[model samples]
Target: MIILLIWVAVLIAVLVLYLRQIYSRFSRYGVKHFKPVPLLGNMTRILLRINHFADDIFSLYRSFPEEKFVGRFEFLNEIVLLRDIELVKRVCVKDFEYFLDHRSVFSTSDSFFSRNLFSLKGQEWKDMRSTLSPAFTSSKMRLMVPFMVEVGDQMMSSLQKKIKESKSGYIDIDCKDLTTRYANDVIASCAFGLKVDSHNDVDNEFYAMGKLSSTFNFRQVLIFFIISNAPKVAQFLKLDFLSETSKKFFRKLVLETMENRELKNIIRPDMIHLLMEAKKGKLTHEDIKPNDGAAGFATVEESAVGQKEINRVWTEDDLIAQAVLFFIAGFETVSSAMSFLLYELALSPDVQEKLAQEIKETDVKNGGKFDFNSIQNMPYLDMVVSELLRLWPPGIGLDRICTKDYNLGRPNDKAEKDFIIRKGTGVMIPAIAFHRDPEFYPNPDKFDPERFSEENKHNIPMFAYMPFGIGPRNCIGSRFALCEMKVMAYQILLRLQVSPCEKTTIPAKLDRETFNIRLQGGHWLRFRARD
Candidate 1:
């Protein structure tokens, strides 16, 4: 018994020393950071539900106002939180090749989840990117407008029915539920080549499957936390990000869709069809023009990396992976943005009024037929969206893993020498921190759409606003997401005026538990027919 106690004591002592050494790497390099605890590091408070990913990390960022970069420890990992715009510029664009991959988020054992474009590393990423780039081009988006409109019409039909059945002409809408359903149906139509009236058919298999797959529930939160921090352990244990049911449903759906489409020789203009064309090597660089008629100022610009075609034979798994990736990205992120957009509109009636007027005038100008071009050209609508994203970006932050040893330079002019980020070191860009900083955006908390005005937009510094993400590896589906949200917002605003309901929180407050953007008491609002 005494020998066993000594062994246990030695083990604890070794653990303490090891942890102390690992946590002291920042101080050894003279980098600025708060003292991290043994195991959880700076994330101890976050893990204990005291704070969240954005507010907590942004707080650390705010702690060092004069520093260009700060240290952040995610569990046991050291992530350099980038604060300087020039540093952001280099990391995202100028010297992007050095940091070509995002930090791994899932176990490799999960084929579909791990092999998606977001998870692909190095050359595989480039090939898949160029391969899929044509599917999101402006011309392609033009073809997709009708599909989006069809979904919007379905959503309006469902909402109108609800209002019709109600004693009051207006109905209290769960903004999150409404937007998620609309986004679900839109992605279902555009990406998966299926028609789903999610608002009307609330218990749909596709919608249910998607929600289960993408939602960050309490258990899922723990699973993903482990996966993100200890990927090898996750892979060894086969702790994939997706639930088993989700894997089966999506895999079968994608493969069967491709099979049926190929066998029947049915050609459609949706993403599946485009991906099928890519499989046949029919897609090429010419699909992109100098100006791709991007949906809004908030859209991610197509770069030369995604422009170059890399010849490779696509596989069945590869195809399924891309389809699933696009589905999850389109479903979750777009829904989050749409929900937030509606919340903001409900809060600011003047913005909604102006947006509705623009929609009405544009509809009249187009002779009651507003297409992709007309909607994209709406300056006020774009400005509102830009501001909305700046205030509540769907993605709280961005992460990149350094592939090669690179000099990160000084934390600030105050520091003596350069700080080198070694290979495999993780770097984080606090997108919300930059977006909400008073220096870049005056009165950052205020909902001011005029900041994105044509005259004033250029005055804003580059790399300050990254709603989708930053650089060539930014959110690939920004075009589709923007178009999806805009089309639905136009449909809703043209018919309904949203306002605060009894359940609505006056000022938005974040839910402390989840990493995703969600309101504290739910996103509830009243939607009535326009006067």
Candidate 2:
């Protein structure tokens, strides 16, 4: 008992000394400090379950609307949550080179997917980004449009069958589940060039895994909390994000596909095929089929670093990691965006009517078919999507770390406070707080699509509207994801009438425990054919 007491005393003293250091550091920068507790820092209330972290962040931002930035501690680490729109602009856009990488806890080697775009940084990120850029270009998306349309057709057919088979004349739909399957079809066709028919097979291995990744339980959340909070120590211990099952499944899948493609000359216009072309120097060559995977390059450019052969192919691990990440990131964003989009439609019938009119007119102009240009050209459709993203961003927070000591200048207009960012300090750009700021957005609680219209969009500050992020490191698949979502929405709206169900939450709230911005409960809505 005496030993336990002594150990507790030592821990308290250590915590106090650490906090005093942080406090002194903030004082030096002339940044305002939040009243913090001993061990858990400013997040004690959140960690103790007294309040949700998102709400706490919102409150903090609201409390000091005049300040350009606020200083707070997350345990021993100092975090600067920037509030001023211009300051955000500096971090994400104008001066992005200084804060390029999102702080990821996992090491690439610990799993097959270590070198994914999300985890890569610096020169490595630049090279990979350049290589993958052409894959998602307008022409590339045009090539893949037929596949996306086919998936949407399959989804509509599947939903019709489910509705027909329903005993109550109304099918109860788990919006997340339906959207996940749709996303599975999208990713499968576009990423792997394989069609698993997730619409018919809810239990399909890929679909199940995708759904599991989106929905987390208590244990998974706890493990994530630990890893994120102590990433360096976790990395030193060789901890990984990919579960053993996911690692085995994806690694085997990518390797077998590569081998089969090489043997059979099976070329496709998907991401895997593009990466394979990069490996063999055949990106510019036309008429290369999947079976032509063995096609060798005309010339191999030397690696910029000169450490590797220019024609050196990606290893099996590299292919698998990239493939898995493509599926994981691509699927979640598409599915979540659909969920929220539908959630909005259910709540606002006037908005739905306007969107339906837009869809109908565009289809009529396109020879009664929802062609590429028709769907892509609808201006209101684009604004509605943008507004959905602005109100409920697919991600709640965007994170970065100070790679070098930098200056966060005070608000140029208001001149409230200034601060120096130290290296290794983690920065959490609370996207929700920024999106909901009434000062930047008038009557922010209301769902307003006109906010994204051509003239109105300019009224908003530059960095204030980044759903797909900004800078060179922004989401590479943004166009693809948007295409898939728009296609799905067009097909569904054309065939069926959607209305909010009792199970749907009128004002959607988030599950704080989950890592991403997900609904507190699953999005549920009723669908009827528009006959």
Candidate 3:
């Protein structure tokens, strides 16, 4: 017994020394960081669920306002949060090649998640990005406007039905569910070429599966944390972040869709068609079959079909992976944005009225119809959406991984003069923190669209206002997302007045459990039809 105790004591001492060394990493480099606890590092708050990831990051970001960057640990792995907008600009754009990839969670062997554009590193990411860029060009977005508008009309029709059914002349609606249904239908039409009326049929198979795939339960969250913090362990254990069931479902769906399209020679102005063209090594601006009279725009003429020398083709798995990414990403983030926008509008009646007036005036100017050009031309609508995004960015933070050694230099005398960031270090840009910082926007909590107005917007710093991120790695579907939000807002606000009800939370409180920015209770709004 004494011998066993002696061995145990030695083991404990060795571990303590090792962890002390790990926690001292930032101090060695002359960087400031939150004091770390043993194994948990500075993630105790997040791990304990005392605060959401974004909230924790924001608090830390605010804690060290004078520093250009602050170090923290995700377990033993040190992560540096770039607090300086100029440093953020340098990392995201000017010296981007050094930080080309996001810190990878899944191994390359996990094709389902690894092959997607978001996870792909180096050349693979570049190739896929080039191939997919044309699919979201201005002309292609113009082609998609009719489809999006059709969904918007369906949404309004659904709301009308709800109001008619309500005996009180107004219906209390869960804005999250309402926006989610609209987003599901839009993505279903645009990506899968399947028309789904999620507003009418809430239990539609596609939407159900999409919800399943996007949801992160407790077990999944734990697994994700482990994979993100200690990827090597996950790789050694052969763990995949995506469920096998989701993988199979999406793969089957994509295969069937491709086979049917090929068999019938059917073509549609959507993502699947463009992906099909890419598979055939023929994706180009010309290959995009425009909607009736829609004009074509310039696109990079790059073939992404196969590496002929290696005989490795962009397989069906690749197509399905990308399609699934598009569906889930578009579905959840857009719905989240729309829900927040409506909730803010409901709470602030003055802002809502002004935005509605702008929408109505723009419609009148365009002969009572919202077209691609007219929707894009509404300056006030743009400001409101921008402000909403600033308050509630769908992606709370942006991450990048160092691919090569980088010598980061100080912009001014206040910061460290020269710091060497080794390859493989993870860098974080806290969008939530930057957006909410009072220094950037005076009176940050106020829902003021004037902050983003033509004259006032120039006063805001460059990298400080990145809701969709910056540089080549930014959200590829930003334009499509904005179009969807604008069309929905235009349709709903023009026909109905959004007001707070008995159940509406005065200042929306974010749900602590989920990482995605969602309100604690469902967003409840009373909608009354305009005469």
Candidate 4:
């Protein structure tokens, strides 16, 4: 009789807890707006469909246009979604210190590729950024021009093979697949110093790994959330962030590369060589010696005393982590950008003709070569890429964690109460929302490259156009991604004409499993060789 009573009491407690959680999550806002659910919050829509998340938030913004920032909840955690462009600038750039760390799933012991520049924080991130800034300068990128050209030539040759096989006047192919192959090959050469023939070999190892990184299943997304949201629990339970198979393959590949490079004394202009240089404490040609007590015989002491400089204080794991991120970021972002570009070009043939003309003019200026200087000065191409980013960002949105307490600017008349932001709060800057705002961008839905024109660009507010995000923590590989995309487009446009097929969707739907912006259905196009 006593045991039975205890069991009944336990059951009642659980039921009450569950009911309380549900009530708090679905509670509607009386004045400001509706509150998000407890554990699930707005995530149910995200889990159900990617387009739904974008649509739901867009609808919410339309419903509460008066509110400067909307109160939202994700997995029971409260987040503020900034609507006003001025306020967004304050959150993402002007007052960046308030939100320093990016929300990510990582631990100290994760694979080195897992903790690169994208997910690092505080002093460590600052140090890494400062040290690596020199590597991406114009001089360095110029040195890499030949390397890029080699890859481009190889890609063009592969495309010729595909055209030959088609025999038909035009080929019906998925441009997305071809672009992804090209991107994987380029990044592999740059990161691992290995040449991947992904264009020729569909089942190439590098290509397979690249595809696997972003191919998250339904269960995997759930697991990723559990690990990301509550890392402490995951750690206690020894939960894995990456699949065991992926972890093993990447670890082995990185290890093998390090071993071979060290043994052969090989040197390349890629990221791996730069990282190896950091390990050797020979980043540059400068030489220095430690200071000693002043003495009459300064010459003798100077000769005896050695340099006190410590070698670069990063581990091999650090290099691996950085390289992995470069591979993933460089590979995926560029591919997506190309995919969007194709979709737009296919929809608008006039745009394609104009782009091809620009490419030809630029190529002629470089003495019949696609040189660095020539590629960098293509303004119309820049406009096209910018417009593409506006329509389809590589990532869905940028997220930041509050490092210190902050305010959502001064309160307005409607809700005349200051938003007291506490530390540890998550601040979400919706790239899609800002890009689609009709206020900042008139006729936001239209695909017009002229919007990014120099004359009209000033009209758009500062942080309102952040496809690659803003502030000090912006995407480091923007240059590389842009360069590759431009080169690929330049090469392909010179030969083929792009047009939308009967099967093309007006607005491509995004996949929900992965957080980054990607196509749910493949982007297909018909390509005809120009006479």
Candidate 5:
């Protein structure tokens, strides 16, 4: 008993000393920051499930009003959160090579998750980016629009069926689920070259595989933290972040699909077909598809780097990894974005009315049929989608790993010297927090689309709004994603009027325990037929 007690005391003392050594880093460097707890670091509230992640970040970001950047720790790992617009611009764009890759979240040996374009590092990443960029060009997006519109029509039909079956005149929906199903079909048709009706075939294997892959439970979360904090340790132990079931399922699907296509010489306007063309060096950037009006605020332009040719042979697993990443991103992320946008439309009736008016006008102007050009050209639709991204970005906070030692100038005027950030350190950009700052957007909490309006959009500070990220390594799929989002909003509003229901929270507060951005009670909204 005495020996056991002694060992416990010694272990606690050692832990205390270790924490002090790490926590003192920011102070020693003269950087401003909040005091972090021992194990949870600055994320105690979030890790402990006491406070919502968004609100916690809101408090931390606002707490340091005068700071250019603040130091933070995610359990012993150092993070510098940039607050200044110029610093953000430098890290994300000007000095892009210095911070070239996203920090590792899983062991690199995990081919499915780690081999995807998002996980590839250095020159490998650059090559893969160049290869994949042609598939996401404006012309490619134009080709995929018909597939998206087809999915939108299916979703509308599904909703109409539900309304007819409802005892009440209106059908109350968990917009999250509705959007998830819609997004599932869109990704299926566009990315995998598979046609699916998720609403009709509720228990489809593809949908099941997507949910299994994307939804992270507590064990997965813990595994992610372990892998993120100590990659070498996780790799040494062969800790797999993704389940073997999901890995095998996605691999077989991709391989079999490729085999069938190759055997039959199938021609389809989808990502799989594009990727096969990419493998043969036939996928090159085409002339930008022209639209009569603005391409919307959330759209990302194709850079010269994206257009440059590259030569690298891809393994079959590499092909599978990209498809699976596409599935996860399209299914989980775009679905959440759709849910949030629907939530906003329900809460703000006037905003909904204006957007509904635009949808109605555009539909009528085009002789009661919508096309890629007609939908993409709506300025008001663009503004609303932009605002939705601002209020609830797909990735609330993201980090970039420094590849070389770089100076971050100074934390503020009072600092004696520029802070030299070492190689391998992560520089976090709290984009959602910056978007919510009152200094940048007055009455920041209000769901106002006018902030992105043609007359007022130039007023937005640079790097303050990056829902699809920024820089050369920014989302290649941003244009594709925006197309998906806009199409759904257009389809739903044309058929139904969204309004808050009994299950909907009045001033929606983000759920504390969720990894994803979700509402407290639920994202519940009533969809009544438009008169």
Candidate 6:
């Protein structure tokens, strides 16, 4: 018994020494960080639910304002939170080759969702990204406008019916639910080539499936945290990020859709059709070339497998993966933005009024028909949406993995010597922190659209207002997302005025349980039909 006790004591001592050695890496690199506790590290608060993930990261980011980068242990892995905009630009764009891959939680072979653009790593990501780029071009976005308009009309009709059913002229509506339905309908039409009435049929299979697939419930959150912090352990355990039910549903849906389209030879100008074209080896280099300003013209290095070999065949699994990505990414992000924008407008009566006036004027200029061109022409609407996104970006933070060893040394900075970031290090860009910083956005809490106005926008530094992120890995469907938001907002604001209701949360309290920046109790507002 005495021998056993001595062995146990020695083991404990070894563990203490090991932890101390691991924790010393941050200090050796001159990186400021929270003192780590065993096992949990700086994530104890978040794991305990004492503070939200976003709140904790935001607090950490704000803590070391003068530091170029702040280090923190995510579980046992030391993650560097980049505070300098210049360094962010370098990591995202200039020195992007060294950080070509996102920190994937699941491997492609493990889950269908993991094969999507967001999770795909290395050359596979680049090839797929290039292949799918043209599907979200300006021309393609314009083609999708009619589909969006149809859904917007449905949404407005549903809102009108709600107003009629209410005893008072104003009807309290859950903006999140309403926008989600609109987003569901739009994504259904554009992605699946099916006109789903999500507004009327609340429990429609497509919408329900979408919600199930995207929801970050308690179990999912825990799994995501584990996978994100300890990817190797997750892989060792053979964990899958996507639920089996979601995978089966989406896989079956894609297969059926593809088979039907091929059988009928029905050509729909949508994402699925474009994906089908790629499958048939009809997609050319011109179709996939980077046209957007956000995607730089820098030539991406050739993969181990040549371009010709990579483009030879696009399989069924690949098609399903891309389709699932569109559904999951499109539905939640667009709906969230729409809900928050409407909620903000409801809170700010003056901004709402001004925006409504602009829409009305633009409608008159276009002979009361608000087409794609007219929607794009509205400067105020653009500014308002930009500001909304700046305040509530879909992603709280962006992460990249160091594929190669990098020396982070600013030129002519003798005081701060070169710091080595070893391969496999996780680099985090705290986008939410940057967006809310008073240094970049004066009076950051105030909802001011003028901040993005053509005259005032230049005053804001580059890389400061990255709602869709920067570089080649930025949100691919940004154009489609913007078009969807503008169409819904325009249609709603044109006919109905969004106002604060009794149920509306005044300060817009965030749902701490959610991974995304979601509002508590939904975004409630009253919609009054314009005479």
TM-scores, in order shown? 0.97, 0.88, 0.92, 0.87, 0.95, 0.94
Which one wins on lDDT? Answer: 1
Residue pairs clashing in model 6 are: none
TM-score of model 5 (CA atoms): 0.95
Worst 10 residues of 3 by lDDT: 292-301
Q: What is the C-alpha lDDT of each candidate?
A: 0.86, 0.72, 0.81, 0.69, 0.85, 0.81
lDDT of 4 by residue, 370-420 (tens): 866766678788778788888777765778888988866533455545676
After superposition, candidate 6 runs with Cα above 4 Å error: 285-310, 410-416
How are the candidates ranked when ordered by TM-score, highest leading? 1, 5, 6, 3, 2, 4
lDDT of 4 at 192: 75
Higher-ranked by lDDT: 3 or 5: 5
Single out the weakest 10-residue window by summed lDDT for candidate 6: 294-303
Candidate 3 positional error at 431, Å: 1.0
Residues 404-453 of candidate 6: C-alpha lDDT, one tens digit per residue:
99987632233256678889999989888899999999999889998978
Lowest-scoring 10 consecutive residues by lDDT in candidate 4?
A: 293-302
Task: Please give the distance, in angstroms, between residue 28's alpha carbon in candidate 4 and its true position after superposition.
Answer: 12
Report how far residue 479 has shifted in candidate 2, in Å: 0.4
lDDT per residue for candidate 1 within 351-374, as digits (tens), equals 999999999988888886767897
The C-alpha RMSD in Å for every predicted model, in order, reads: 1.4, 6.2, 4.1, 8.5, 2.2, 3.4
Error of 5 at 378 (Å): 1.1
Residue 90, candidate 1: C-alpha displacement in angstroms: 0.9
What does candidate 2's lDDT look like per residue over 102-220, in tens digits? 77555535565458777777777665665555565556776777788888899999998888888866676878778888889888888888887887776888787766654555455
